[model samples]
Target: MKKKLIFLTNIFLCILFIRFVSAAGTAGSLNINIIESQCLLDFGEGWNFFSFCRNLIDKNASNVFSSAENNYRYIMRWNQEKQEFDIFSPRSSRNPVPDLNDDESYFIYFYSNSYLDVNGTSPGDESRNLVEGWNAPSYQLGFSKTIDSLTLPIEYQYRYIMKWNLSRQEFDIFSQKSLKNPFGTIDQEEGFFIYSKEDLILNIFNMQ
Candidate 1:
């Protein structure tokens, strides 16, 4: 009788251990969906500066621009390290720009007005590192936000902000110290150039 009671106690302990392990596994393996949203981009004739706010499943430039293949002339990306433009033409055999990233911006020249529809995942808690000098970064938010709404990292300063004017083909400038600032709000799918005084990690959008 004593031996049987010991055996029953051991069995109960074993079951408890198994249940504990199962609970631990479930807690450790929590799945979070990152790509939970979609973004639609509109492009016009001349130069359209744009960026993807969400993480794309397929980032290949050719595949992303497949819908507007015949309409666009070329796609250009800024080389921050080299401080030059890397252009990719669909007709060209040797292309410099291959993939399009979420935090980066690109310039596409279209023959006529067209739109790009893409399904992407959310950029949750993602931050972009800005180098000292000129950096072309996209606002990775779903809605439109003004330039004043942006918050930079401590000790880092924004010297100026410039947005590409599609019709005038000129830059609309914005500065904090300027008496008259034309550049006001930043829209979705829009890309802009910002000059940073120091190198720091920039939180593009407030998660809250």
Candidate 2:
């Protein structure tokens, strides 16, 4: 009778382990039904490297994007200047906008203006320069599931004002990393939207 009980307990544990693994697999899957999907704004074959961003005020690039992961590569390329994008990831101010519009959901970038980023990522003051000629980039500004379920940036100078769509599940940026003093000095401007003006954590927006 004791032997029978032990056998049943082992069987139950085995079944529970199987179910737990299956559930985790389901949660880790990436949903393909994005807000918008386009093949026209291709990333082009192989790896592509860019070098600068046009001023946002030059034109409005809201509502025009490809995907959210790699915003710079999926913009509508016209005249080779590339136009129409949502997010901006600052890479040394070189290729700041990445594309006219960013199709990706997450990244680091240079914003046109801190206040203007709330204007639907339109053409505006775009970048993360603390001082003139100090075009220091706001890197590590994208998403990372490898750390946890879904995590936002873990850097102070990497803020991007995002218009999040819960139902559609998207983050369309209007303004990105722009500040009077990204170096955390008293000379900083009025402060970014919900940001603490203070360097709270290395990585904010861990998705609640």
Candidate 3:
């Protein structure tokens, strides 16, 4: 009877161990889903090095280069002057400056890995912080506010805000000096190069 009891205890322990292993494997696989998910990038805070995808340009290199984690790539940046993309790859001899302006939102691609997981990510912010310099910032026009409806100080009225037409790919001057129609509406997706007289924060709340 004692021998029978020992055999039964051993069987129970073996079953428990198998179940624990199975659960652990399932959890590991779930991490792959997080890596494959899409995340938005906001340039409101500032420009910095970003790893938008899970595959690194150099597969054998250490994960220290990628802030996102192991098996991730640094992706590419845009050249505003050249209107071209500066991509990072092992084959490229010269690497261009990786910087993105607030003028537009970009879509990033990634290589999927079934073995990795992403713990958390920040998509950036809708609002932007500006210093006492030229800032090319874009914000979604909220509530269809007309140019005239927007209020600014009398001193900063003329030439403070420059509106961009995405379709034309050019900026149309709008200021008190130009005497442009204040009733004209600005698109939210369009970028506005604002010349800040002082340090201030620009927030675009009503963006879809």
Best by TM-score: 1
What are the runs in model 1 whose C-alpha is more than 4 Å off? 1-36, 152-156, 206-208
Candidates by lDDT, descending order: 1, 3, 2
Q: Please report, in order, the local distance difference test score of every candidate based on alpha carbons.
A: 0.71, 0.24, 0.37
lDDT value, residue 59 of candidate 2: 33
Per-residue alpha-carbon lDDT of candidate 1 for residues 1-208, written as tens digits (9 for 90 to 100): 0000011111112212222336446533333333245556767788888777567888998998899899999888988778789999999888988888788888889999886766566565657777888888877665666676664453238788888888787789888788899767777657888888888777765443
**Per-residue lDDT of model 2, residues 1-208, tens digit only:** 0000011111112212222337446533332321211111112232222211112222333323322323333221222113223434222344344444321222222112111111121112222312211111221111222212111343344344323222233433322344332222101011111222333332322221
Cα deviation at 52, candidate 3, in Å, is 15
* Candidate whose lDDT is highest: 1
Clashes of 2: 38
The 10 consecutive residues of candidate 3 with the worst lDDT sum are 1-10
Cα lDDT for residue 25, model 1? 64
Q: Root-mean-square deviation of each candidate, in angstroms?
A: 15.5, 20.1, 18.4
lDDT of 3 at 90: 33
Error of 1 at 178 (Å): 0.3
Pairs in steric clash, model 1: 35-121
Error of 3 at 166 (Å): 5.3
Model 3 lDDT at residue 147: 51
Models 1 onward score TM values of 0.78, 0.15, 0.37
Error of 2 at 153 (Å): 8.6
